[model samples]
Target: MGNYQIIATAAMGLEALVAKEVRSLGYECEVENGKVIYSGDESAIARSNLWLRTADRIKIKVGEFKAYTFDELFEKTKALPWEKFLPEDAEFPVIGKSVKSKLFSVSDCQAIVKKAVVERMKKYYKRNSWFEENGAFYRIEIALLKDVATITIDASGQGLHKRGYRIDQGEAPLKETLAAALVMLTNWKADSPFIDPFCGSGTIPIEAAMIGQNIAPGFNREFVSEGWNWISSKVWDDARMEAEDLAKYDQPIDITGTDIDHRMVKIAQENAIEAGFADILQFKQMQVRDISTSKEYGVIVGNPPYGERLGEKKAVEQMYKEMGQAFGKLETWSIYILTSNEEFEQFYGKPATKKRKLFNGFIRTDLYQYWGKKPPRQNEMMK
Candidate 1:
């Protein structure tokens, strides 16, 4: 296992959370706009791929350089030590994106990078003919932002959000990565009751259940890099074992999800069972306004409808007003709501304690937090 630069790409507005997750895994990282970068060996790659809950994907930073021309791009790309990562029969696909750069043609950039990598591989592997590419897959990317080219090989095959448990979902299902972020941002602890009123497909509750149990988001999935020869099977084995050992499977949690749609409730139940939390998580068909809980010091995190489509604004706003009326009475329960609607607080009847801007996919949204009063210390009570 050789030391290499690693990049954990995250959604916009989630770089800090991703960086925090990386650091918690015992690796130092620098948080960028949409990425957290660090250096680590194979174990770092494997562990990050398995443990990073908030990242979109883990990438191995191949090389970065300034490229103003096609020739410069090809030469600099070829100069990187591709042989160290790519085997003789590795299947390398070049995908590219160019932004505010002289190399404005993405297809040309990808083609040039591919040709350059092939040329480099031929020279290093001593091959006369073209590569058979019958072995491990290496999806390479060339990103040019302001004339700087950063190349990386994808380590997580599908996005990390594809936790492989969702057999069904609603029309607008929230990404698991974003769902986990919503849970992590709340004041809810494993011992406290957690609820998602508008839990479409039950993503929030399932993610909360996993978090409450200290389960690795990637524990049940496989990564693209797991097929690479350079990274030993033992590396992945060790990472999995570490995940297994660190999990709090026996921990008790009170998590619930309710949706207005009965079909969505059924789907959520199926997905939870698929995610191995059938008994740990509860789901039901319920409306937001009717949500009444006796549990104090709990947290309510919800991703309600943004009413972005036509004619839905009126109904959604009414629902929001009802949510305000319902949730406002629970003074001991903190509430967090994610919505793109700017008038959310106005309709919800109270201003947020604090607001954090976040993007749900491409839609700009804000997390409106209502902090609840803290629970009294045991000694503060009458003796």
Candidate 2:
């Protein structure tokens, strides 16, 4: 039940979304370049790991201080209360990264931090012999920016984006975190129709289904911190129970995913079934040109090929033109497209209502949004 400083790390350009998710989980946080800073008890650690859909991973901030030299780095790291987090048999591994700092050698920094922690642990636990290192893992990180060292311990073993659903994938698959973010950015309701026209391996549709049904992204996953000695097993159990209690399993959602490649469609179906949405999500092998629906006020989202490779721009742009023409008929349907093409609007034959810059794994892209007419309330419809 000890309180600690927590950090939920996010990918570039997604710090706000991660912060929003942290706030939704009842934690006050400050957004930084690529992480959200907050503080809470053991329950907060478990709960944040279970929630926070867009975060890369959850980390515990152990120490932060200035380090001008190797001795300064080692002494400062040794001075931190490492005994509070690591047990005598803790298998803690130090990973390091240096950016714009005097300690330019990452490997050197990692070695020094590891030695310092071992020294501190030896002093506290009265161990003359070397640590057997055969115990639960505690991955420690030493990140230096401008001579300031920030040390943290990873709580979420793997990244949170590893939702454990997509056993199969295509060549250029979208990350589950980014997929979830795309759905969150839209003005979509659970009851309305949702689609991903360029659904590669069915990531967007599966993510949308999870969000629509109010299911926690980590509902079906395990975290690293569950093995820690200090945190009670009941903390994780209670957090899981909360997730189960909050899920809207009975809520019906109209979600569809289609791709031009039949192989991709099959892969998408397999992934959707694996995600426990076998019956809820529909997948089809269809081209963007053939996409048409009579349903009004639905939402369309796509991460189409950006035509970054040589000699493919003309054909991709032609497809964009056809996609625009086909989608132009559904004036009531909002369209959200993610692409690196600067002239996406020009090719799509319509200006976006709003466009947002988003990074798709180092390839900068824009999320072009077209607002649809808001649907009337059920009571108004009855009237």
Best prediction by lDDT = 1
Residue lDDT tens for model 2, 1-383:
79999999988889999999999999899999989999999999998988888999999999999999999999999999999999889999989899999999999999999999999999999988799989989999999999999999999999999999998999999999999999999989998899899998999999999999999999898999999998989999999999999999999999999999999999999998889999999999899999999999899999999998999999999999999999999988999999999999999999999999899999999999988776677438877
How high is the lDDT of residue 240 in model 2?
Answer: 96
Alpha-carbon shift of residue 96 in model 1 (angstroms): 0.2
Q: What TM-score does model 1 achieve against the real structure? A: 0.98
Best by TM-score: 1
Q: Which stretches of candidate 1 lie over 4 Å from their true place?
A: 378-383
- The residue pairs in collision within model 2 are none
